[model samples]
Target: MTDIPLEHVHVAPDDGADSEPAPAVFVLHGRGADEEDLLPVAAELPDELHVVSLRAPDPLQGGYTWYELDLSAGGLESSQPDAEDFRRSLDLIVESVDAAVDAYGLDADRIGLLGFSQGAITSLSLLLEEPDRYAWVVALHGYLAASYASLDPDGIESKPVFVGAGAGDRVIPESRTTAAVDRLEDVGADVASGSFPGGHGIGPQELEAVVEFVAARAV
Candidate 1:
């Protein structure tokens, strides 16, 4: 993955305000989806915001995946993200955020994150590592990875986070989803969670809630 360069798609406000940096949102797609997969969602954000979607480094099943899922022991076990690769990607993203703030003239303190599935997992991991970095986060159809258990909510500043799951999702079981939300809330994160009626995907209702969540962060 190191040999391959990181790729991304950037969408600036269409209101002819290209020269000034504005608020920003980082969009992350699910496993097997490319950077552009979430552009439509990005477009739904405030027009004064700059949006950027990033592609995962590793390739899988002809698409891209953030890491290798280790489901060997009957049920889902863990992920096999190359430690070095994961570290490098993390560093690059932190740098990217800083670069976006400068290059796009974004409000440095108002950056937010939106992600689905594996993308959501990555976003949450990043936030746990640096709680003060993002103003808010919207995670869809995903849970907090077990590896992040070492993160304590008491050690970090409070921040808003939205986690939406599918009530019928077997992929990420309800127990795991509930546990994730509980853990985040226990750690002092202002967590807002809900369940859509469907399964492992976001529907129109979830999108509406996500937009409202992000909008409220602007207040």
Candidate 2:
């Protein structure tokens, strides 16, 4: 197990409006990507809200990866051996979110998580595993990992979730995306979903949907 530390860079509101006790959106990036890749997305979001983009723990060959992958194995390499270490990274992220909330005097009940691809997987997994931790979750171009099937949805029913996928996403099959949405709905999450005609990435329409979802729920 390797210890991975979560690193973050904050993007303050452009409005220069006095920072209110507003909820934050923690942005996570995809595989081989860095924290800066998704930080710009915050600009399109409501300026009244806070945005924090984080870097994954481990540095890969060209960039970074949240967990190791064995292409030969067909799926994620067993993170079991490194579960404790991996979880520690997640703990750091959670702590960071709490710190941001406290620092800004934001309403804890309004905090949310937003991630793309691998980051999306992490966001969804964390929310499912700790149902009461976040008020809302936005997963873009990411599928639900199988480990989430064991989660108890007692506290998650009222939590809002926005899931978006590319219709032409060859990496994540449409069936898998539909299944993920079904599972979340079944578990009581207020789920809203959409699919765009593109590859494994977010398009203009997808971004608009995300903005709407967050604006309606986070504020």
Candidate 3:
């Protein structure tokens, strides 16, 4: 059995660079989804990226989840992640991505992260908790978890980040996404953020922006 922490789909670069170790992008799916959900996004990325889409550990309602929701605050818009599960998922992803650097012959310094919904929340968490590990980040329809409310910004200076949210998002309100963007900027990260016209999903325009932002920096 493989030692990688999470279930994953790895797509090698279509037009690989003329080098031994390839750059990589880790794709994390939204809650109630599996590793396969975001493969199409990977296809649109630079051909030089070794894309790896991850499956969250906990299975839920015929799908998967990064962590259980803590909706004690009333509804989906006010929900938070269960702390224990969130931390565990973050640890597993960190381990898996680190291992992948060796297992897949990836360039460690060129690693990127992309996620949606719950996955997006986790992506932001990862970027904050271990900012030096990731070279770039794209988080969609997600917010900064409460646990990282006071992260030190010294390590992630000028880190590149892309955040997306739907103007009509009921699942994860655009306000939350904006808060995440604001925090990233406060921490001195170079962030590019936008709002779409749909509800809790990646529209074409947002998708194009994600593609462009990553393509420019991932190179």
Candidate 4:
């Protein structure tokens, strides 16, 4: 129903900023997942904020993938191509977000990005590449893609970043998450990292931390 295509349908909360200028949250899903996967998490956020869940452009065997993958690669190598594809998709999404902000009379400085797995990689990439784009960034169960080393730290505007990962994540090692947190911090981002007891998925504590981060930034 939103202006984006059916594949990009965003399940959002009804409430948003009461003032003419509102804050917005863009939700990106994990690999093999659709936009709907994070819609429920939006409900846990402050009701006064607008939430938009974006779908990946590439369709996988059954679900979806942000970009191609090569299993032969080690660590972050397997995610390089997909990360690049997500960067390209982000260009279009940022334009869409600009249009949405204008249409809803939302504050541009209040926009935020929330992502999981591959989506988290995209979110962090965007933040590092375009530091001023979002007020805050939330990355769950993902690490910084290899391409992150090329980013210029001075370009970042010191925005708040929330990195949450599981201690038992088999897909994404906890070491990778810690390395990412260190990278973002070194790049002048005010980052907060948390670890959950579960596997490679969101837990209640992580969700609560994210909600708190978004709510604090929305004010």
Per-candidate TM equals: 0.87, 0.86, 0.97, 0.88
- What are the per-model numbers of colliding residue pairs? 2, 0, 0, 0
lDDT of 1 at 64: 81
| Model 1, position 60: C-alpha lDDT score | 73
- Can you write out model 1's per-residue Cα lDDT over 86-179, one digit (the tens) per residue? 5666777777777667666678778888888887877888899988788888888777776685688443556899999888987776566777
Worst 10 residues of 4 by lDDT: 4-13
Each model's lDDT comes to 0.76, 0.76, 0.91, 0.77
Clashing pairs in 4: none
lDDT of 4 by residue, 1-219 (tens): 345432554433455324566677888888888988888887788876777777777788667777776455766434465556656677767766776776556678888889998888878888887787788889998888777855765557467999998999888878888889988887788888899889989989888888888788765
lDDT by residue (tens digit), candidate 2, 77-117: 22121355446657777877777776656668777889987
TM-score for candidate 2, residues paired by index: 0.86
| Residue pairs with clashing backbones, model 2 | none
lDDT of 1: 0.76
lDDT of 4: 0.77
TM-score for candidate 4, please give it: 0.88
Over 4 Å off in model 1, which ranges? 1-5, 18-20, 77-85, 153-155
RMSD (Å) of each candidate, 1 decimal = 3.2, 3.9, 1.3, 2.5
Clashing pairs in 3: none
